[model samples]
Target: MEDKIMPTVEELKALAIEEIDKRKEEIIGHAKHILNNPEVGFTEFKTSKYVSEIFSKLGIEHDANLALTGLKGNIDCGGGEGPNVSVIGELDSLRIFEHPIHDLTTGAAHACGHHCQIGSMIGSIIGLIVPEVKNNLSGSIIPIAVPAEEFIDVEQRMLLREEGKIEFMGGKQEFIKLGVFDDVDMAMMCHTSATNTTFGVGGTSNAHIVKYVEFTGQAAHAGGSPHMGINALNAAMIALTGINANRETFLDTDTVRVHGILTRGGQAVSSIPSQVTLEWRVRSGSNEAVVANSKKVDRCFQAGAMAVGAKVSVTNIPGYMPRLDNPQLQELFLQNAGHLTTKDDIDIIDNSHNGGGSTDMGDLSQIMPTLHPYVGGGDGVGHSETYLIHDYEKAVIQPAKAMACVVIDLLSNNAAKAKEIKEKHNYNMTASQYLNFQRSVAEVIEYAPEG
Candidate 1:
């Protein structure tokens, strides 16, 4: 009797790509369906159910309704025990009413191409679930769908926090707190982009803090005795102006971004505004800068209250940290991507390049090896009504194939590559340290003017 031979690593990669191609239509359909029926963070009940149904159909075992609307599924390769790798997909959309495909009643829209994330995540799973592939591979695969990545609906999230439903506003932050990622040794996810490159890897994002500010004053009839009333709206305007005035103090190297929206002004035009509320954000390339700039912004709010004899209260919410990409993991992804497209089509973003955006994935990256690459398949500015996915193949199928190949390389041969990467990687913080630091960032400051 002759001994059986194992498939070469290249052969296994080809098999994975072939499997993804075979299920391309189903994968693309998932993205299209999600785009049409958009749901915003934490309130993604319908979208969650849809993803749950798809997971069930594929015979994937999962837990549902996590962090209000998150889902986590697991698949154990029949080969052996090793490391667990997670593929993440965000389950929330932005509240863009003007987007063409937005939900009519809720105005929820996938203007940021998160729908394609779900497609590609599932596409990778499809490629990896082939009987031969699973039998030959070691360890486990985790598919996680997280909610509320957009961090909008601040008041509603505060209510949830008060109710003890969630302590953190971002879905990934909540997941970290809940120990959902405890077992995962490494993780990766692909985002859709409108750039010229077919695939992009690397680049850092900003660390930020969310602010919910309230100004309180006395209300009086505007038409009759306007002098008797204090105007909260005026105070808010003064604070905004003060923030703008301090912009010159910020350094270009810090990439400081301070912006916000006024959620409420006055109830009626005939009366002075007694209460005004605002949702503001402070972002920078480093945590220290974010903290320093946040203090400056808070002082401006206090100044506004002093100028108008109104009381101001500011609630600071912990936002995302700057991204930290793993070079070894990036090289693996880049290598796999090169197999799918020409080298010219891929973009290797510098590690120091900060995009001035923020994401919770950065929080996860601080503790483990993580990859957040981008796939081009869309046109129009991100988070805008005009943003739309034009090429499903590029956005979903290609990344899926590349991710599947990378996983094959990591998990095959007793997961030697995964272990090597894990051994060599240096974590910036432990999970407990991250949680402690984020919790420390939460506080409320109030200012009242002396008469």
Candidate 2:
């Protein structure tokens, strides 16, 4: 379609700089629309449809509702010369009772700014859709408007899995199971952040956290023989206490964090809780280290259960993977970002954000050389009700340009970078193996009926 798209490294940077500035209003407006209509996880029906419509208008071919609510759109702009890379943008929100822009359909808000992610991705995709850019290709640029990144309603998803509705616990993982990412090369994505880093910022490598620790125990009237009941609430509290006591064991650089809440402690305040589900998360510098710490954290639950004489189930559902920085991808992003910002002062977070939060992009990284950087959003805390667009135009525009710059460079740069990235991060997953991994996580988390 486009004259065998292959733009030089320099050309890629220049193209993004010139066009990104031009499309400023268009991209920001698109982001605002999505922001205004925040959709919850796995139910972004209208959002998916709207994204599909965008693809249709641009003449880009895409498939939607992958892994429940994920959307995948691809434009073969690299002219079959280099690696095929996917640009992922998560499209779900989590502010159920928080945020000014809340969606009534799902009682959710795009507090995490996932809505903005898809918008920036669309802007980047639009920039690549130019005839000259597409024809001068070096690799494939596929934009994925993915869903269910929040990992909400875990038990509901577990039931879905039991009924054979979905294979993976999360959207990206399900896409992986459906052979969605089995194709070409590298992938790039970004998030709206509050880290005070402007323009471009790369935080500490994130961990692939397994996100659960549930508890169950016998119930007895608190006023009448409380000792007779194996208090599940007590078990959960014991787990929390153990984790807090062990916090000092975590290395400073490792940045170990473990915290959770008790869901379903008991209906009546006077009753000893029959069951409690501890929604917990553990994050660290590396997935392996995080997993190791997660295991130790699990021991706390185990000890708590033992202390309370109640059975406990611990499930480690896949969360975000340890976000790694690829010298290859980072250089490309920096070079592109440098078109607007200087290289010497290109701010990069060496110590990663240990902000006690997690994401699903970690799974995508295990499969490819993915870059999930932070672009600015208005200066309010994410996941809070007060989060608002401080400066919509600048906040949305810079991120959009940064993403477009990366896509152009990846799609137009020589085949070397793309090829190496694909080979290096190629998903080493077998369907059976992935299924087993899911089952193993389930086994660790499955709650047993009261005995």
Candidate 3:
């Protein structure tokens, strides 16, 4: 009788690559479908459902929840292993993009290419489970569909938080509450961006940024009783000016940004507008600095509120998670990218110095060995109506393939690689530490708004 010998790692790797290549069209199609039906943030109903169908067809076990819109599957690369790795996909599409099919209801387009973000991750999962690849499995790869990376619509998110629907603002942050990463050793995510580089390696100094500041005072008749009512709108105006007053104090190294506008200054020209709302954002180069700067800005609001004797309540809507990454996983991505693209074409950015942008994945990075890399789609412009890719297939497909390769190589490969990544990152952050930090920032934070 012929022996049923297990497949070797080399054979499995080859098969995984082959499967990814062969199913390239299907994967891209899935991505484009998501692109065509762009959903914004947590409102990814169709996008999530469609991805769920795909997962169901694959016969993969999944968990659907209020937080995670798409599917999450567990693949035992190890018959029984050392560490489990998770490969995640962002399901919610950016609301703005340079597309013709615009949603009038939501006014959302897939501006940030999240449709493709989750799509590539999902496709890679399918490729990872090809018969040959599955046969050669050695570790675990958890495929997940995560929600609300964009963190837009602060008022709605605030409502969600208040209703106990979600404790944290970002999707990944909420997932962390459920101990999603308890068993996962490492994590990987790819961002579709505008740039032609080997590996877009940079971590965002993500901030626990604030969104809304409201000041309440008694409203008086416009022409009748201006002196009797405290002007809440005026307080917001003064707060705006106060922040701007200290703008010169902003250090060049810190990407300190403060911008705001008074939503409700007053009803009439003659009367005092008591209720005022200021929507603003403050950010810096890294997570810590952002929090520090926020406190300063929050104090400005407090001072202004006190100046007008208006009751003040500043609520921070859960904003994006700043990029906190594992350099180990990033190095692995860089190495695999070198193989995918020519060396001259790849530039491994030194983001150790950059912590300016914000992303929901930053929350995940704080958990496990996570790496979020950008891919060049066009010029430096993103989230703009004019933003576009020169070649949909070349720009997106190649990076999609690279992301898949990274997940497969690192997660489904030998136990040593995953172990090395997990140990190097030392994702020892406690749940309480993360939650404490979350509340600590938005409540007590003071700062100027970003322009």
Candidate 4:
């Protein structure tokens, strides 16, 4: 038998893009279906099933029910042995009760445009799965649908935690602990954004810590024995005040963000409030700043308990690390994006641009080469009711094409580019080190006033 000749990288990319365009309608339809039937993190049973069905129809092999309602599929290139690249899509939606498209029963809505991510990921798979494209590449592609990227529904997630269903609050963190990414060498995922009119590359996100707080006090009759009970609701309010008071101390460069919501206020109107719970978050530009701000927030909680003569318990949960974008991956994405859109429409952000948001992709970046970029077809603010994807092609298909092209660039030529990235990459920590650091952040503190 004669040796077969392979196509050039550009030719492979063109073929992939054509395949994606041919399947554009189906991809867009899938995204719309997800938008109309949104599910919250770790509970995306319907979404997971939907993705699994699609994978099955495509003859792709995958592991379902990962990290609770997440899924991962593998596509072997059949070229040779090399690094495995992961194409990721988050499978959860935010809880926005007021959104017009929100699920009335669960208040879940695709307000963050995660639906588009799934679409793009599938589109990328469609492009890369052509026999010609696959045969020319030297590595594999892992298409992953991850759960709970929004980090909402803390109370329910905590309940799941207590039940031993999950250990970490964020899906990607749990995926890490479960060794889901153990075989992968690099990863890429594009997020939808309304801040730009075109695709964006390069940018860092804040590091953060999660806190679950409870204030306990005595209950008494509201009308006759109000003074006999300590006011837990009042304690919570005072804690908010304390938190606000310390905001002035937050340095501007540190990008500190301290905020939370009161989940429980009182049991009934007739009795004084005895128990109150809050879900709090502290974020900053760096890990050190996050730790410092977290301590300050914890002290504020204790201060509220001391002032109101109530007992308080604070459970600190580990959150995302700051995002670390790979330079080589960023350049590849930029080059490919430029091919699809003009320079004026695209913004190449510096590595230092702090997005003031957090993602578990940051955690993955600490241990491996990863790319977290943004694509625009969205309008209004992200994670809000007003956010909507107006251009499906730009939001989904374009990103898919760009990623497909990048895959070709990295893996088509005997995967020499991927090998180079792996060798030159200086990761911040190993997976084991990351797990240890997160575990150290988990702690419980109890406080009561001394008589």
Candidate 5:
């Protein structure tokens, strides 16, 4: 009689990588298609449909429209009895009108390299779903398409909130509120970066609060009888000046970032502006600093309204928490990434190294073991017009293979790696506590000085 031999974890990973490599063209093509047809957050109908069609073709069981434009698909491992691991992709684009490939009408652009995220995510799914790989793993894998990670479109998102479409502006935040991450035990995702370095891990991000500001005043003729009207645009300009004036107070160690844009300055040039709107963001390294800076920014808004006798409304929306990457999970990613590149190409920063940006993934990391690493394939500045993917293979295939192998490592051996991680992780907060804290951040303050 012939003896039966079980496949080793490395053999299973090799099988998955081979499968992913086989479909490289298709994966890269899909990413390019997404790059050409960009859509903004919460309005990714066509993009959602495209992702759903691909999921259907892959024969994966998926639920769509969880948070308006988000989608989740699941594949259970035959080995069974282990944690559920999630591979996530962002499905929205930034509004970069000046980008060369930006939509002519909508101005949506993939300047942040999110299109590659979907490609790498799908590529990882393709790799892990190979029958040979699935049969050997002991847990499930979830490939999810998430929405609105950029945190733009503040006015429109606030409208969505009023209509009860979502409780939070960020996709992951809303996903948490909707119980989308409830079943998932651990998560990992790779973001495309302009860095020529092959891979990066072990860094933190800023915590932040979102603000929607509106200044209202009386409208009158711009060229004629201008004295009869109050200028809301002037009030907004004063508010912005006040904000700038407080910049010196920000501590260098705190890494405070306060920025905003005037989304709507006026109705028409012929008329005095009656209302002006702004989308503001306040971010800092620590949560306490974020709270303090947010209060100072609010006072600046009030100062603007008081200076101009305009009624100002500031709506504070809860933003992301500082990112806390699981050390164990990051090591797994690093090990997998090492297979494709030399150690010199990878940069492993300190856990306290703040990237000076914010992400809702940070919010998820507060409650679960999550990994948000960076991979190279892109050049030019992120969120800028010049940003473009220069190497699809590095941006897509390598990360996909790495993520797949990481999953195999975690789920193999009856998911010993995942179990160890879960047992050792000391979560910062529970879902209920996170929700209460976010809700407490929500408030609408109206400041109208008495005459």
Candidate 6:
């Protein structure tokens, strides 16, 4: 009997891309379906069920209800044992009430194009699981659909934390705490962008800390007795003013961002506000700057309470770390993307370029090699009503092809490239250290006016 000649790397890539193209309509339909039916963060029961059904149809074995509404599917290649590679898709939407496609009842909108992420994730799986492709590749492919990447609905998340349903707000953070990523060696995901370029590789995101604040005061009829009651709204306004005032002190390099939403001001306009609540965020280019600026903002909150002679409570929740994109993984993604589009059409961002945004993918990057590249097909501002995906092919199908090809390259030769990247990569923190650091960051500080 003659020994069979194994397929070349280029041949494997071609096979994967061909499979993705064959199912292009099905893949794009999934994205549109998700966009029409959006869910927010941990409350993504519908979206979770939808993705689970799709995984079931594909005959992928998976665990559901992870981190409240996450799904992890496992696909073992016929080639052999090797490093596990994760393809992640976020399964949450922003609460953009005015969005054209927003859910009327829930106000959830896929303004960030996370729906595309899910579609592309499924597309990549579809391509890789082809009999011819999987038979030649080593290692495993782990497809994940995670919830709560937006970090919104903080009050509800805090309640979840209190009930022990979750220890962290972000899905990836909760997954880390639950040891869901223990077996995974490396990961990659694509985000939808509205940039002029077709694809972008290499860029950093800010580290951040989430803040939940409350001020308590005495309530009285505003028109009847204005002097008899303390105003919590006034206290909140003062705190916001203080935050803005301190902005000048922040260095440009630190990229400090302090922003928040006043969730509750007063129940009725005729009465003084006895309670005021705010959901705030502090973001910076580095963890150190995030910590330093968080403290500064906390002091501003305390000052507000001091000025109003009211009591204040501030809860500091661990937020996402700055992104650290793996250079080798990025190069692989870029090469594959160039094949799908002209090389000049792709943007190569500097490693130090911080986008002033935050993502839980950053948390994952701290422990292992990760890629968070961007693909274009959307228009208007992200996380807003105007943001919408115009070309499903660019947003979903092309990314799927690129990611699938990258995985083929990594796992084709007994996962030679995957092993090489893993061995040379330096982790910023071990999983345990990361958990400890996040736990330490969780604390509640209460202050009452000194008598």
Best by lDDT: 6
- What does candidate 6's lDDT look like per residue over 138-165, in tens digits? 9999999999999999999999988999
Residue 395 lDDT (model 3): 47
| Number of backbone-clashing residue pairs for each candidate, in the order shown | 0, 19, 28, 0, 0, 0
* Candidate with better lDDT, 1 vs 4: 1
lDDT preference between candidates 3 and 6, better one: 6
Per-model TM values vs. the true structure = 0.99, 0.87, 0.89, 0.98, 0.97, 0.99
- Angstrom error at residue 312, model 1: 0.7
lDDT score at residue 98, model 2, on the 0-100 scale: 52
lDDT of 5 by residue, 90-173 (tens): 999999999999999999999998999999999999999899889888889999999999999988898999999999999999
The TM-score between candidate 5 and the true structure equals: 0.97
List candidate 6 stretches off by more than 4 Å: none
Per-residue C-alpha lDDT of model 4 across residues 1-451, encoded as one tens digit per residue: 9987667888999999999999999999989999998999999999999999999998899999988899999998978988999999999999999888999999999999999999999999999999899988988999999999998888898899999999999999999999999999999999999856679889899999999999998899999999899999888888889999999999999899998888999999999999999999999999889999999999999999889899999999999999998999999999999899899888888899898999999999999999988999999888888999999988899999999998888887889999999999989999999999999999998998777
Model 4, residue pairs in steric clash: none
Candidate 1 regions exceeding 4 Å error are: none
Q: Which is superior by lDDT, 4 or 5?
A: 5
Query: Which candidate model has the greater TM-score, 2 or 5?
Result: 5
Which ranking of candidates, highest lDDT first? 6, 1, 5, 4, 2, 3
lDDT of 2 by residue, 318-358 (tens): 66555555657877777666665566535676535554456
Off by over 4 Å in 4: 1-3
lDDT values, one for every candidate: 0.93, 0.71, 0.69, 0.92, 0.93, 0.94
lDDT of 3 by residue, 55-122 (tens): 88878777776473645677776445657767778887565534554576776777777766676786
TM-score of 1: 0.99
C-alpha RMSD of each candidate structure in angstroms: 0.9, 3.7, 3.9, 1.3, 1.5, 0.8
